[model samples]
Target chain A: MKARVFIRLKSEVLDPQGQAIESALKNLNENNIKNIRQGKLIEMDIEAKNVEEAKKSIENITVKLLANTVIEDYKIEIE
Target chain B: MKARVFIRLKSEVLDPQGQAIESALKNLNENNIKNIRQGKLIEMDIEAKNVEEAKKSIENITVKLLANTVIEDYKIEIE
Candidate 1:
């Protein structure tokens, strides 16, 4: 199965990179820009006998290292 | 308008971060992992008199700085 791991900053977290982009946009005269956030998406192919085990593995990896639980959230999609 | 900038490495480019994650997963005994590719998603809100101008601004920014065109592909989603 193929899985996609999405790692994003928690809503309350401050994102400096996003802030820089926003500032750049402001320099370009793009108006009313707000709440810019950046995130990561990792796509991988994995093998499992069934869907459940695949999900379990992805979930485990997500919590273990794929995302920083204190300031990030993650979601997985199976394809 | 709101736009999502989806940036992924071109298929021919190697992604070291993805490789490291794959290696980590292998160390954990996860099986059949391959071709892990990591990418970025940036979400932002902007204002324009109309959709076309917003799209134009986003495209300009994307080409100018949001992504490295030589090795990345970007898609913009307007909302």
Candidate 2:
């Protein structure tokens, strides 16, 4: 199975990278966007025996390393 | 309209962040993943007059600042 992980900054935290990009857009004279936020997406292909095992493995991946618990939240999709 | 920009490292380049995460997963004893790649996703809400204008605006953003053409490729999705 393949798992896709989307980890995004928590709502309460400041996204400096996104802000910098927005400022660069302003400098480029493109003032059409009202807002933008940036985050990370991780795609993984696992050689698990079954879907349940794949899900369980990815759950541990997210909790341990893929997603930072302090400043981010994650969503996992299986295919 | 909402435009999502997904910028990812070019396939030729090594993704150190992804490698580190995968190794960390191995250390955590979850050994089912075959491969992983990480990238950035930027979500933008634009209040443009029309779709074409919004697209043009984002194209400029991507070409000029959002994506580094040398080592990354980007995909734009509008909603």
Candidate 3:
């Protein structure tokens, strides 16, 4: 199975990197931009018994290793 | 308007960061994992006259500033 995990900072969390990117974009003349949030996308192939199992494993993997749950949230898509 | 841009390394590009993450996952006992490609997702709100203009501007921004087109590719979703 193939899984894609999108990990993003929680709304309340401060994202310095995002801010830096926003400023960079503005300098690049993207002056109309706002609320620029940056995140991570992880694409992985996994061996799983079934879709349900894959989902469970992916949830665990994301929560435990892929994202910092205190500040980040992750969503998984499996195929 | 809102836009989400996904930036990823081209298939032929070597990603040391992805390799390190894969090894780390293996160390964490995620033995079933493979092809662990890591990418970036940027979400932004933009003031645009129309969707067509937004798309064109985003294309230019991505190619010129957001992604290293020599080794990476980017896709944009506008809403």
Query: What lDDT does the true structure give each of the candidates?
Result: 0.86, 0.84, 0.89
What C-alpha lDDT does candidate 2 achieve relative to the native structure?
Answer: 0.84
Best candidate (score: TM-score): 3
Q: Which lDDT tens digits does candidate 2 get at residues B1-79?
A: 9898888899898998888888887788767786688999888888788888888888788888888999999888888
Kindly indicate the candidate among 1 and 3 with the higher lDDT.
3
lDDT of 1 by residue, B1-79 (tens): 7788889999999999998988898788775767899999888887788888888888888898789999999988898
Clashes of each: 0, 0, 0
Residue A21 of model 3: what lDDT?
85
Which interface RMSD values do the candidates have, in the order shown? 1.6, 1.2, 1.0
At residue A35, give the lDDT of candidate 3.
89
What is the full ranking by lDDT, best candidate first?
A: 3, 1, 2
**Cα lDDT of model 3 by residue, A2-67, tens digit:** 999999999999989889888888788789888888999898898999989988888987887889
User: Judged by DockQ cut-offs, is candidate 2 incorrect, acceptable, medium or high?
Assistant: high
**Tens-digit lDDT string for candidate 3 (B19-55):** 9888888777888889989999988888899999888
Least lDDT summed over 10 consecutive residues: which range in candidate 3 chain A? A57-66
Q: Which ranges of candidate 1 are over 4 A from the true structure?
A: B49-53
